[model samples]
Target: MSETRTGIETNPFDRDHYDYSSWFFWVEASEEQKAEQLAQQEQFLRVRPDSSIGERCFISPLAAIQVETLTLGRSSYISGHAYLTGTLLTGPNCTINPFCVIRGNIRLGHSVRIGAHTSMLAFNHTITDPDLPVFKQPTSQRGITIGDDVWIGSHVMVLDGITIGDRAVVGAGSIVTKDVPAGAIVAGNPATVRKWRVPELAPPTAASVPSSGPVPSGGPVSSGGPVPSGDPALAEQLRAFDQMVREQAEEVLARSWDAATGRYVDAPGHAPSVRAHCDAIEVAAYLTGDVPSQLSREEHVAWLRGLQDPASGMIAELDASGHPGPRVTDLSVDDAHYHVLCVGYALEVLGSSLPHPIHAVDELGADGVIALLDSLPWRGSPWRSSNVADMLGTAVLWNTRAGTPHSAATAAGLFGWLHTHVDPRTGMWGADDPRSGRLETVNGFYRTARGSFAQFGLPLPHPERVVDTVLAHAQDARYFAADRQNACNVLDVAHPLWLAGRMSDYRQQEIRQVAARLLADALSHWRPGEGFAFAADSGTGRDPLAETPGLRGTEMWLAIVWYLADLLGVSRSLSYRPAGVHRPEPAGSLTSQ
Candidate 1:
């Protein structure tokens, strides 16, 4: 019965072949499969529901899952692969670029742009135990609000509970952990505005036009490029300068002595001068060779009280007006020249010398000083006048003061008023009339003030309005000149420009590049042999400070170096290890050999 074989290959179109077809047919015919197919068809129809989209409205196939949930206004565009979850409540004309991951509650205003691969996460975690795993922690949520015309760069990560103000620019790769003030350009880990956006030129009118030729260089003149020659002799001079500085600093430190009240003071002759006073404080604190006393405790509180000025909430410049003289003219407080600087210097020294809890002077008990700062009318008009630095210095002091909520609000308001008068063309502060509030007249003041504010954590009020005005004036490349008269040459300029780039969508790349370049050029001027020169043209007789470089110049260079390094994200290589070999203290330390 291995029978006469069937000549045909067992009904090729019969049960065996039909069974494969039957399997697929039954599976396709199932209710679940039919429902899924119908759902997919519905999704396609929903995504492209209508072709009439608003201006700036962007809808990518990858980005739009439930298209009805995504609403946009005029001139806004969304790039491919941008995953937006939760409610997308937006205003007019915004841009959502490719590869952005946005989740939870979010609200954006007009003309906003979200760069590629940026993450806006509106969620946080609560950790109760020091040893528990992070995944087991409870989660909390916070919404994100972006004001009108905000430009956010690629790789920006904005955390929960943050509000980005109008016309603000977020630089590439910035981690925003706090709220950004309106019209501010904020960058870095906990983003802050380096500068405000301002216009290029003033309005052309019958009275305002300049009658003279091109403005001559005010401070130092150079060919406006990188230094071509590298002089080893200059390096030697720098080394010599460093030695001079070290010796001078040491001499100043030696002159500081303990008072009857146990607080440090400048000895005799050193007490009358502003620099000497500052130096004494700084040096004594460094040389104390003791851990800072706990500020909240009785020991530190008593020490602070000894330094306070009972009448004015200010510290006296010296123990006695003069050693042997009858008149107090030598150490009189009425000399306005350096009074503000002295106050700021003392506050900074006290803050640094105290423990962490007492770092804020306002909280440590200094109401009179705060009141005096508030009462002083804003001077230093026409930008480069003498009192400008004092205005900025006082502002710094106020920002660091720790006090009641009302006090903080007052400080914030002062800052707002100061920023309101910034020159739109030059990004400088200080005008003849603070109330006139014209940007063109106060360019230099604005530039200096902007830098000072960047160091402290004060928010830029109305960032969008400021930026738009500045950018309008930045059309000329000469505005980016690395010279004293312009904002580009000084450290103030660099910091603000860096901040502006981080916050704005329009000039992020340009501003960062310029800032980096300026920093590099300035640092290159540092001679290993001599201390840092005022400019690249120092030895060439092109720098104004070359003939008489002193503490002011040197301090400025050091501060700039420290800040630039910080902005560039450079970190110290040294690490603390309990088991490692101990080394001698640094020469700057109080107990140096």
Candidate 2:
């Protein structure tokens, strides 16, 4: 049952795939409305999958809904050919007129009326230099928020960062560049206020829009909460959506499980991946319990141990003959260092340890490790610099279990280098590129910090600044938008904010808002019982519709969602904290001790 009203009174999810046109709109003029009957359908049939849409929401069959994260309020009306993409949250009874090009981040209040040919673009391109092409410039997102009982006229253009106050009236042909005052009438190029409506003559206050797609009421852009739920109906819908996501975790593991090799493959025909196997195991342990992979503990452990290189004490993939080979491959699964965390943690979750001590960089003292850390491309790609942290963290993890001394010295030396090199201003490995910084360094900061600082239970020297950089980077349209948000980038933004949350509340509410939006965004990409893809249809070429769900994306996103919920203080709702690559709690390391 829908929280309010399924477009249909019943059977919305008929195996027949109910025709949205049948209910595209039954609420028009009378006698002609004979075709009007209640339609009961699943949220996915009409809108995007993994959404929590309210009842009686009439979205035209022809609506081009590319919005990754959308939550339509009860009785919301979106007319045909409305190009809605990116992330949009709407309160109930909202009317999105035909040809409304809502290009990106936007929030709408209840009973809001948007006229035809209106355009709301949440990000603007940077055109600093006359010589530079506009296409080449970067875009920034401040998002647009519309208050309750708003009325926007036809041919209106709402630019990025505009807020239309409650009961506001935007005249046709107006261009809204500044904030619209409540009960005011605005018309003109820049959409300035002309006169305020008298309060006495104003319409009685309508019910507040139920936070179906609630905008950040006030405060920083980021805040935490599960599904903008100011209504009981929305709260119920959030629970259902979450239940569906949890069920997908089981399907993800079951489909990818390989009984023969006692591991998981990317898909049916794809070769087995070391990282995928570990990712699946971590996901299962953290989110889904006893997933029934059917591989005996001995069989699984043997397969894992077989991948280890005794000489290097690192794990690798087996060749066609089922034995570890020395062929260098340019894949993350083949990257021995990554396996240290993914594989090492996977083993821990399954009641085992790395079969051998990590001698990858063994016997290194303070000077030796310092010299190596100094040589890395710290200023270039922070991601590259973080690679050694995995080896070092793994050294501490495995050594503590195996009772070795090398981990302490190596960890101590690496910590010193990180502290000495970390940029105080951004609290990242490198400074922002002031001109066109694509959040590479900030993202790298998370990757690097995760490996060493967060890995060994060490606090970042400036955790507050880390939150600042991560939140600021999230406002940039180039990286955080729907088209650009892949599993890795989403993880990069999510983890740093989550890690910093443990240390400071500098922007706590801002972090919560980010948590709510991103939680909705990640769920939007979900494929129901099928799990997630590395990218959505709007993604950078990795389409889940054409291919099977990716293990890396599915696992990481399932974990990222936990982090998002944690930020919202609803992580207990997830029922478990991630113990895999994105674990919140620090590892119990011998080095730390």
Candidate 3:
């Protein structure tokens, strides 16, 4: 036996011996880093000193192997031999089993349980070009968000850029590659719904079932799947009305292209914009039809062909070049990020419209879009905030469809890049470097800003920290005073406030009060003929007070209205109780009835 550098013996018959010296160096470095990491870990644990813990918790011995950031919730047990590194955020009453590897930026909702040996990683390396080493390329990381009451089975791997919705269950050994919808049970390599949590079924009752009747082809079916004794005239009338709307929508979509181009002299006004045409096609295709209406199909295909920029395989906002064309506004035609976003939207609409599976154009489809997105040097570009966020949102939607590893990595990178730029004190994002000079203010108000960043789905980076930041800013009565007109600054306040409301009850009462006050102020500015108007006192003059129904003011008002309604509904539900209430159950246990 040949003696190795570490005094370990190599197989005597082997011509080449293993490099034990290098291996020893790696081991030594790992040990030294582990010690330093432990010290840092202790520091973070102390920072959250007021956190509560529950009884009968089990933390594995292996969990102590790496001394990195780990936070545990009350009554939560972490099994032995699990490896947790980087920031781990857990809510009350959770369980994590043995031999799991959870690394980097993780947030777990209440009552979440991870079965044995699962891997949850929030960071990935770029590997598009084999010539360049993976490490040399940028590394991207995001927070892994597991919603309330989620049950992840043994040996499952949930990668970055995924959010497991509330009450979702993941089967053992499955790899989740997309957002698992709420109340779903997913399993498989790229996990898909094996079964729905709540199966769709009509209510059953003896009286509801017909004793004996021939099932009518176009009539309502009873509980026993027999035709019910109902007026056929009503059904016929409803069907006719539905058909009329479908036909009208189809006709509108079909004529959009010609109407937009002014090809027919008899047509009134210029042809509709590309976006308008595509939007109409989408509505027509999905609207109550056994087969896609002929007009919907023809218009959809025409829009797809027209949007394609043949020269670069990029989709253009308008047929003409440059921004602010006949229908297209903002962002240049050659803007890689915007083009990719438009392409993703177009493809998604097209994909949903098709009755059967369509083969993706391998070299020039999603892959090409990803390539163009990654190629753009966003590190120091002037349009990083709006443009990068848009591209990232599109990439998330595309990756959810395609499930490509590269797409996932790119999405994570974009989030990681955005996370770093978030103002530590205010939880607001500024323009990224290289483009930093272009932005007049770091976190200034801008129209079309809410959806721009809000499109990045649930479980944002350092969510708890973000929540704290927003609460801190919001509570400073100065920001919420009746005279304050900055409430319309969606990026700096409204969007973050909305996100915080979704996460936790940290400042639930305060947020509700502030939201109510803001709504009252907004209503004061509402004009009778105009849909909604921007406050005259609003410091930013970028948004013009207008009655245009589709303007930014209208969109922001709708979003605010939805947020308030959702919060009120949730509050009302929580207030209800039986005549005499039993012991309170964990919040996570509740699911949609």
Regions of model 1 farther than 4 Å from truth: 1-272, 276-309, 314-413, 419-456, 462-489, 527-530, 533-537, 540-547, 566-593
Q: Estimate each model's TM-score.
A: 0.36, 0.57, 0.39
Write the residue-wise lDDT of candidate 1 on 498-582 in tens digits.
3443333334344434445555555555433233444444344554544232323333454454333323322011011000000
Quantify all predictions' global Cα lDDT against the true fold: 0.41, 0.63, 0.43
* Model 1 worst lDDT run, 10 consecutive residues: 578-587
Better of 2 and 3 by TM-score: 2
Candidate no. 2 TM-score: 0.57
Candidate 1, backbone clash total: 44
Candidate 3, residues 452-546, lDDT tens digits: the string is: 23343334444445555555555445435544444244224544544444433445556556555554464444333222332324444544433
Quote the positional error of residue 308 for candidate 1 in Å: 6.6
Candidate 2 per-residue lDDT over residues 1-593, each given as its tens digit: 11213344435364222122223354432332322322323534355333445566666555787765565666776776789876676656788877889976576756788988899997778797889999998665555767667799999999875667656789999998766645568899977766655342222222321221122211111122112333344345456766676566677777776667655776555667777777777666544443235565445555666677776677766554345657333222326778777776665554345666776555666677788778777677656666665566556556544445676776678788888888888888865565547466876787787777666555678888888888888888776776556777778888887766654546777877877787778878877666777765474455543335767777777778767765664544443445556755344433222
Worst 10 residues of 2 by lDDT: 217-226
After best superposition, candidate 2 residue 75: deviation in angstroms? 65
State the displacement of the C-alpha of residue 100, model 2, in Å, after optimal TM-score superposition: 66
Question: Residue 43 lDDT in model 3?
Answer: 56
Candidate 2 Cα outliers beyond 4 Å, as residue runs: 1-238, 258-263, 320-323, 327-334, 433-436, 539-548, 589-593
